[model samples]
Target: MITRRDFMKFVGGGFASAMALGGYAFAFEPLARLNVTRYALTPPGWTPGLKLRVVALADIHACEPWVSASRIASICRQANDLGGDITVLLGDYATGMNFVTRYIHSSEWSKALAILQAPLGVHAVMGNHDWWEDKTAQRNGGGTTFAHRALSDVGINVYSNRAIRLEKDGRGFWLAGLEDQRALIAGKKWKRKHIQGLDDLDGTLAQVGDSDPVILLAHEPDIFPRVPTRVALTLSGHTHGGQVRFLGHSPMVPSRFGDRYAYGHVIEDDRTLIISGGLGCSIGPIRFGVPPEIVVVDLG
Candidate 1:
């Protein structure tokens, strides 16, 4: 019954199965290494009165197999160490699909929020993922509300089409957050219908005055063109900078404006936009060239 030929076939099949499992394990291994790349932005007309160093982390997509609580804690620690006056979390915190529940159960997200500390404060906004996740719970009326409450408990100020004025060293600036474009485009029946209307940057700036530099925190970088002239700088993180960019270039960019807005800073007219590559991956768990980042803007 134990012929040499049959035994060989059995061993070969077992080896193939083992190899397949090993490959799967290896594919997801890099996600465990949570490293946040840091970048600095200094605008030309910035005044030295504030000397504010703002640290921004966006597109966290906190879920299993990608970003973990331990990893998020480490990122928070690093931001604290940098000693920035303010820390801004751009949106897409959850995957908002089948993985939405996974984000809900993420202990790392809660832990990460607890560790976030800044001299001024921490602020955030919702992204496309937030809408997608909430839409799933339209009938139950619990999904989006739960996410909002969870983030609030963590002390992150989620600004949806709103602005908060901040004063430092006798100098003042405005921080504004806009509703995600995806939600607006999805129309009235969208589950996250509460997140209607785009942010009125001009209206918000009117309250603060034109002289004061306004900093906008929008989830999707595509909103850059819509930003008003008074907005000196805008921070965003929806693209994940083409998560799997090849040879220093992304395969495809979903933005209407094309590849120029794929990643990093872009100066158009008098306004400046900085897009973070983000701290997590989407679709596949691999990050070949596009690494996660934490952007630092020195306004002096």
Candidate 2:
């Protein structure tokens, strides 16, 4: 019973409502809600009474109009205030996407992340973005060195297929840092042989004790399955919580593992993997259901 004019008005109103909702998703929610989630995990070698807090901050794509250097520093301060025993940075320091990619220096991000404090130490591992120049540029291999130097210069031990032993309050365990798997694959494809050290997981784990509980630091969650059973937990970030989630599932997860291990805690038999939603954006600076975050894991 509606006239053509009335129908057009209804259509226009629906379009306007949709645009408003899109604006909130693209602009409001991404910047407003920064979440910090706490998880309680008991690894095999963890002492009964001692609680070790490990804070992880990932994907700090320090770019303009979305993530600034000041914001990075603020994020570090927040993580430090959490009183963590150790802090791990999962990398993506430079901004992504060809749209207005600001060449925010690696040192700028390191200076911000160095503000983080932990009793044990602050460690970092490179992300795929760190190995590549930009979303579209040809891979030349200098980005990895630049990224590592920046963090190392600031005293954040950047690891590539490396393991370190830590003794805290009479309890000792091992931590292994693995390089970004995508970078490894790309290197192999391009016949680049210099970066083989980063992908050597077996060599890195060879130093750990057989019975000691180990925590592995991997930037991408896709590496979770390859981790051995000796490793009690693996910390990762790269999917960005699918960057957008609808009805508790993300349609565009970048993993071959698909939605099975997109975000949050996932248990596969005896091994537990915790994937951070990460703090920045790639492709586009828009996050819908997923908010930027830092993850705090307490090992009891």
Candidate 3:
């Protein structure tokens, strides 16, 4: 027979123990790696003579519990195995400021990033997280001037409103990257800002010639409405496709237009957009229906 006080003490102790266990389970539970998703998008003027395999990975918020260097390397290795003609990385390479300056600075993270390689070259753009956290400063050893040199050093072409052309099998296509719309909006008032506008697309396209096929690399899918029809296809990732989805439905999305821009491929008019669910978590540590992804887009 226990006194009331003793019973209450026992209950509190059990509750505390359960909470501790729960916390550990939530943090250290084995991360479930996901299968790569493949899709085909045939844009207008896409030459039948060109058969290209392009692999795109995005929104890898490489933080602890969800994404580590080893995990990112594994994903890269798998992509490499797929024998893609080119690999494109949409942004959010590092989780945030604290994670980049702290956890991701470890040797494992560096080693993981080193594993990312592709034949035609790996191109990328900055995500809202990368731009907002002042990684440009981290790149220059303390000054916000597009400091993604770390990624560049590891063979990634970090493009901001820029274009590069890839020639394959005697045919060529233009790959262009735009600064994230959020970053552009946030830095609108500043002069000499890193952010750029959709107007820059005209100049980027000019370099590749108007008739050439062009694939635009942008981080946020919301920018879809702003892209010109001259762009054959656009690839983005920033939604995480509602990381913790249920019953094949996303419970929440952060876009201003609600669920209209939830996830996967959305084509309007002549422009084809592929939105990757991304390869890591954001805002939380769990992913249910929305598993991470490596998108392979076949262009023929």
Candidate 4:
């Protein structure tokens, strides 16, 4: 029942709308917008009378005009205002995109992270971009990277396949940080086409040596499938909510499972995974419906 002329008009209107949306995505959203996304949940088998307020900041792809040390410090201040019992830096502290006017050095940004104040302390894990940008680590296939050292230099506890126990109001729980999954990219030891990561989930969990509920800090959400129920919650931030989501559906997600782990809290088989939308951009200088966010998770 549609005529050719009517179809043409409809097509023209759709084209105009697309262009307008593209313009907004490229011009305004990535740089001008920020959000605070909060989640409150009690995981299955969570310890009784134990309450934890966690502030998670990730994918900070710091660069000039998009994310700078000053901006990072401001964000830390904002996060401090939230009064998180513990603050976790999920990953991607290095610059990932080339569209930036200038790259913010790891030293500067790590210093900004030192402003974060939490009772349990500030903990960090390096992401794929943090490893990818470190030429020395990629060349040697294994060693200390600049990102790790820089964070340590600034007094941030950088976790590398390690776990530690912390107490909140006399209740004890284990916090574990896994090594990045996409750490070694260009090493000759890598024969397969897929990424060669250095994460040791079982080994890291083995170090717990305690019966307290565990909270795992991983940079990428892909590990959620392999994580056992012993961990009360797993937090990650690498997909950036597809960076251009619309109507809760992202057309292009970095994860193999697509939108499954793109963003937000997901409970699968009684295990919980909270993937933060993250704080910065990568690949390109555009952001759409999924704005830059600081995720707050209240877990018990």
Find the candidate with the highest lDDT and give its number. 4
Q: Candidate 4: TM-score? A: 0.92
Candidate 2: 10-residue stretch with minimal lDDT: 134-143
TM-scores, all candidates, are: 0.78, 0.90, 0.79, 0.92
* Ordered list by lDDT, greatest first: 4, 2, 3, 1
Give the per-residue lDDT digits (tens) of candidate 4, residues 1-300. 999999999999999999998888986777777799999999987889999999999999999889988989999999999989999999999988999889998889988998998989999999998988888888798778999998899888999999999999898999999999888885442343556899999999999987889999999999999999999999999999999888988888888789999989899999999999898998998889998999999886
Candidates, ranked, TM-score:
4, 2, 3, 1
CA RMSD for every model? 6.3, 3.5, 6.0, 2.8
Each candidate: what lDDT? 0.71, 0.81, 0.73, 0.91
Clashing pairs in 1: 69-108
RMSD of 4: 2.8
Give candidate 2 regions above 4 Å deviation.
134-144, 184-198
Q: Give the 10-residue window scoring lowest on summed lDDT in candidate 3.
A: 138-147
Candidate 3: regions farther than 4 A off = 1-30, 97-102, 106-111, 135-147, 184-199
Candidate 1, 88-150: lDDT as tens digits: 988777764343225545334755767889879988787776655565544453234344566
- Candidate 4 stretches with Cα past 4 Å from truth are 1-19, 187-194
lDDT of 1 at 269: 86
Per-residue error for 152 in candidate 2, Å, reads 0.4
The residue-by-residue lDDT of candidate 2 on 135-220, one tens digit each, is 33234532455777888998989888889888788777788898777663344433544333246678889977655578899988
Q: What is the lDDT of residue 50 in candidate 3?
A: 94
